[model samples]
Target: MAFVKTSGYRGLHVFAPITPTREFLDVRHAVIGAARELARRMPTRVTTNWWKEERGERIFIDYNQANRDRTMAGAYSPRPLSHAPVSCPLEWSELAQTDPHAFTILTVPNRLRDQGDPWATMHEQPGSIDVLYSWWESDLADGLGELPFPPDFPKMPGEPPRVLPSRARRPD
Candidate 1:
């Protein structure tokens, strides 16, 4: 299951499952597929800023974090950045008004005491990505294809050319 939380100021924070096989390509595909589904379900527009341009509006999926070396901050873990903020979980309704910076290592424990863990039942029932993978297949059949992978990784099967769209050769 994927849980998306608005970070109030930065952007959306997505929490998704990771399979033990650690296949980077599969992870990337699943995340993008889920993001597309999320955009369709959400009330707002979404876009991926791969080219660093204002490409209209869309739910931007930061897929670079899907790589083998990167990770989203775990719940209750303190981020190593300047303020030492913790990755806290909140009710979806609380997200809009909550200040992320206030959930530091110092305050998380007290919040947990007062309100209890929002994700306490997260593991009670596991979720499968079968639906998302099915969506990927459906999209492929509809001609919506692969997005670019990170430059450092090997060119994946079915991936478009690694060049930025602006630099790619136009077909005659």
Candidate 2:
């Protein structure tokens, strides 16, 4: 179904509609490159799926002085969906065979936020989307972001240890 018809999220799907300026795009590319490097360093494989939008109610992300809008591209910083650069939605899903707690980063178009029936165009070809970004959260928060790994966490070649030798082996 079209993402627009969806309502508020339950569980851990936190929708974040990001409006990227030319500058933001540069940052995103850098981040993506870094993630790729990190994957190579770690044992777990990491991939990204970038999404784009082409529909109603364009997302105008304001990122300026935090107060008065000194938006990028001037008034066009958050231009209409039609005018914005092609956005790439990068979704990262981490799957570790040894790790029981796995989470997914869902990147989708702003269309998902529409309260009305935005899926009407699914039958026909849809236009460009308005918003896109990744949402990362834990499906199992019981002890998420705060649990200890096994004593012998495998370390990939060339990868640095999570802690220095001194820290890994508590100073006695």
Candidate 3:
């Protein structure tokens, strides 16, 4: 797994490369499975909640990022913030001590030359998502059903409504 800091953002991106043998939905299921397990193990510290209002102070694991055609900033991509912080890949050893603000657009190139890419071998071996599929099935059986999709995406069966929970009309 590669741990990265989205400089100027509130969360970390944890990535593990998977074999490209499945469709986007299948991959999403795998990610959701992993995220659910993390939330289960660390209920107070993590969340898979689709809405920020529900997420509270927990770190949100965005399994929805697996959705097809979705775009995301890549490693070293500079954020639009005034400080120009880059989406920096982190070395596990340094992750605890490093500050994201220090890896701005002006500093990353020299850091890269000195340290090399922390994710250089990320694709040296891709794993199958089939193992995670079992967890997804377990979650389904436990009634942890589909999460909400992006508002512009076509409606998916079993998805929670796209409206924010605060705005949704409560049943009388």
Top TM-score hit: 3
Question: For residues 75-142, what per-residue lDDT tens digits would candidate 2 score against the true structure?
Answer: 10122333232222112232112121111122123423333223333345432212211211221232
By summed lDDT, which 10 consecutive residues of candidate 2 come out lowest? 5-14
Q: Could you arrange the candidates by TM-score from highest to lowest?
A: 3, 1, 2
lDDT (CA) for every model shown?
A: 0.69, 0.26, 0.84
Candidate 1's displacement at residue 106, Å, is 2.7
Model 1's alpha-carbon lDDT is: 0.69
TM-score for every candidate vs. truth?
Answer: 0.75, 0.18, 0.92
lDDT of 3 by residue, 29-136 (tens): 988998899999999999999889999999888888889987777888989989888888987788778787888889999999998988888898887888787899
- How do the residues 78-165 of candidate 1 rate in per-residue lDDT, one tens digit apiece? 7776777777878777867888888877888999999998777666556656667677778778897887767787787777787766
TM-score winner between candidates 1 and 2: 1
User: In terms of lDDT, which candidate is stronger, 1 or 2?
Assistant: 1
Q: Which stretches of candidate 3 lie over 4 Å from their true place?
A: 3-8
Best by lDDT: 3
RMSD of 3: 1.5
